[model samples]
Target: MLLILSNKKQLLLQAKSLLLSASFQQLSRSSELTFTCHKISAIFKQSRPALFNNLYLAMSTQPAKDHTEGHKIPFLLDDHTVTTVRESKILVILRGLPGSGKSTLAKEIEQKYKENSRLFSADEYNIKPAIRSSDGGEYAKLDEDLNTCCERREANLIVLDDTHHDRERLEELFDFANKYHFIVVILEPKTPWRLDCGQLKDRNHWKLSLEELKNLRPALEKEIIPLYFGWFVTKRDEDALRKTSQDFLEQLGNFKPFKKRLQAYGYEDKHKLDLLKYFGKTPNILHCTTKYCDYGKVTGSEEYAQQEAVKKGYSKAYTLHLTALFVTPRTAGARVELTEEQLSLWPLDAEKEVMPKDAFPRGSRAHITLGTATEVQDVQTGIDLLEFIKLQQAGGEREDMGEICGGRIHYYENGMWMLTLPRKIELKTIFSGYYGKAGVSAPQRGGKKVLLPTCQVM
Candidate 1:
């Protein structure tokens, strides 16, 4: 799926709708949250940032803080910087050597807050010098930047990926957290995944040989291994990251009502809604305004007036369907009138509509005299008549999609259009009495039925 990050809703909804209709394997629900991304960064971009910042305050929950698990999840960062955040912040700092599974831990943070957080990566913004391992200055700048971001007062979940060598550098981070009053969790992997650096040498994708690390390994160990000195714990698994983020948010607040508001606005019960609320309340339109405005039923059931189309012993699909098309003049305007015969005989412009010259035709006594207005009938036009009292159900294609010849016209009530179908042949004759040219015909809908409001000059 193409990423359309610019219009979040359009991108997410359309993609979700499309995906729901298809069958796929190896699905990671978070990745499927299809939204197109623009290069521009607003406050809300970067993984439901608004929600993360509000992790501890904005939303309030029922039992207050969730301490059932015995301990509050810790927040930690390795950069020597400080900061504070509001309601729902969950800060995680991952410190380890390059191959010690820091990225994997970072990914777990994203999965934990799948609805509310996104992973911020170091490699993505790694300076050119850092990429080639040629300059220490780039890494220093990056460390400072990461430290500064961790100090933010609005981060929902900030996970830092870096190496710590001593208390001197860690002090820079501790000092900031002290001023900002943000909690820091110290994390260490218990069962780190070990990779055979040598194995990468023989693969088609490898760019180096097994002998290369012999020289570089010393520098890496000096900068990285000392950082894990006494704090080595093997419990920083994927589950650990998830449990930590969830516990942090729960302590911050209960988000159910907020979730309801989002659901009403058609937002999925996820982190997007939590962020959306934090950003500001979004207005909700009537459900019909949605692109696919499908209700249980709209308009009415229009079936052909066919009884014997299907014999008692025959199939139901064979039944003739007659549509009872009831339409109101979207625009009630004036027009000239002319009889059918007069219209046929007149030298009128083909483009302009010519009404009946005579309001009431010779054959019927109950003629609908549309004064100053005209009702022109095509072969598709017909009328339905009910017994006892004559009820007319107009059946045919409307002249214009939303326009009608002017003079006088009907209006629909509360946008509700109803129709009564006839099953037997006698019902067809009853309709002919009121309409004169009575017949059950199939419905002819012009243009697609759109959710946009009906347009009329009046």
Candidate 2:
């Protein structure tokens, strides 16, 4: 076994870490062939159970070999090469009042799926401790995991486990599967996740006051919610609904509706509106829809999203988040007067809107730069451009660049101050937005080839 582990570095390292600290009792529980803490802890002085990656660690807890058919399944992913397995995407939707056992159901689903090698759970992949609900990045991380699994050349199957209560969030996953030519299995509960007032209070873990009870979910059986950002259009007027629907459909087509609203960033409507109202003069402002609820229905937060995810799919997927950008100057104010010697990158072209007409826009935010500058820089430069934002905010309730934040004062290779805000307003990738060389999907080689890189079962 040691000889085999040395040949696979990642697995060996992971195995080594697990083997050293695991309890002897726990070691006996693991299969000899699979990743196990006992196998990994063999080299370590003490078992550092918390140090192991949860997905690998929890699964590794059963440190033993699969001895069947007079054959043993290898201990590592590298060791157990096999025939293809079936994969499909799942969206488990739980709808109910609070204390409907939605979270418990989700866990059961997660345990069931992990038995398969192809399964990946969002909780296992997205959060570090796995069960904790307070982590800040569960949503974005889950999206990343789903994205990675969809793009994997080696993965034959993948499931997006999550709750999808309504069309808004569920549709995104459905659309993603459709784009990749994969099946979407939507699991609706036999009943939504809810219980009668009397029954809910009977549960041992149930906790809620009479005042707080109103906010809890309603009486439904399958307490699950879909795991993506979403919305719903509601109105009493028939003509208004039709008009609103048409307008919304058009907005969706342009990807404008998803911008900055509940679908884009989960934020309060008033704050979003404050941002939206400013765009009247700046038409490039994106039309983002604030998260829509049923007049007063309280929507779930990030934790509910992951629990629902656990129930939604056949297997769970892994997640990662990446944010990087290319710098470009804003073509305004002080930047207009700067010389090429003082500034770098293309001067912001005045003719274009702050954002392209077709692209979805985000609320204009204020950012401040507090570094010593020897000269008044060109607005055409990124710093000058961002400074203009600071100037605009100075006029409103905003005084010091929206909120105080920090980053390095980077100088271009040619010595120009670059002041910019964090990553915001990136457009959602649309199927129609595919642009590559010669109409190819996504040009891998670069010089303008259209290349749409998706997937297929090999």
Instruction: Give me the candidate number with maximum lDDT.
Output: 2
Could you estimate the TM-score for every candidate?
0.24, 0.24
lDDT of 1 by residue, 1-458 (tens): 23444454554444445445533221223254322222112323566666433421321221111221211122222111111111233335455334444555666555555554445555566522112433444457656655666555334455655543233444554444433333334343322121244532442122444565333334333211110001101111112322322222232123343332344334555434322122121111000000000111112111111112211111000111222222211111112222352233222222211223323232212111111112222210112111101222234221222212111222223211222212210100001000001132211112222222222211
Evaluate residue 325 in candidate 1 and report its C-alpha lDDT on the 0 to 100 scale.
20
Total backbone collisions, model 2: 74
In terms of lDDT, the poorest run of 10 residues in model 1 is 427-436
TM-score of 1: 0.24
Cα deviation in Å at residue 68, candidate 2?
A: 29
Q: Give candidate 1 misplaced runs (Cα > 4 Å).
A: 1-90, 114-118, 127-136, 140-152, 163-176, 186-196, 199-458
Over 4 Å off, model 2: 1-138, 153-163, 188-193, 197-458
lDDT (C-alpha, whole model) for all candidates: 0.28, 0.29
lDDT of 1 at 108: 56
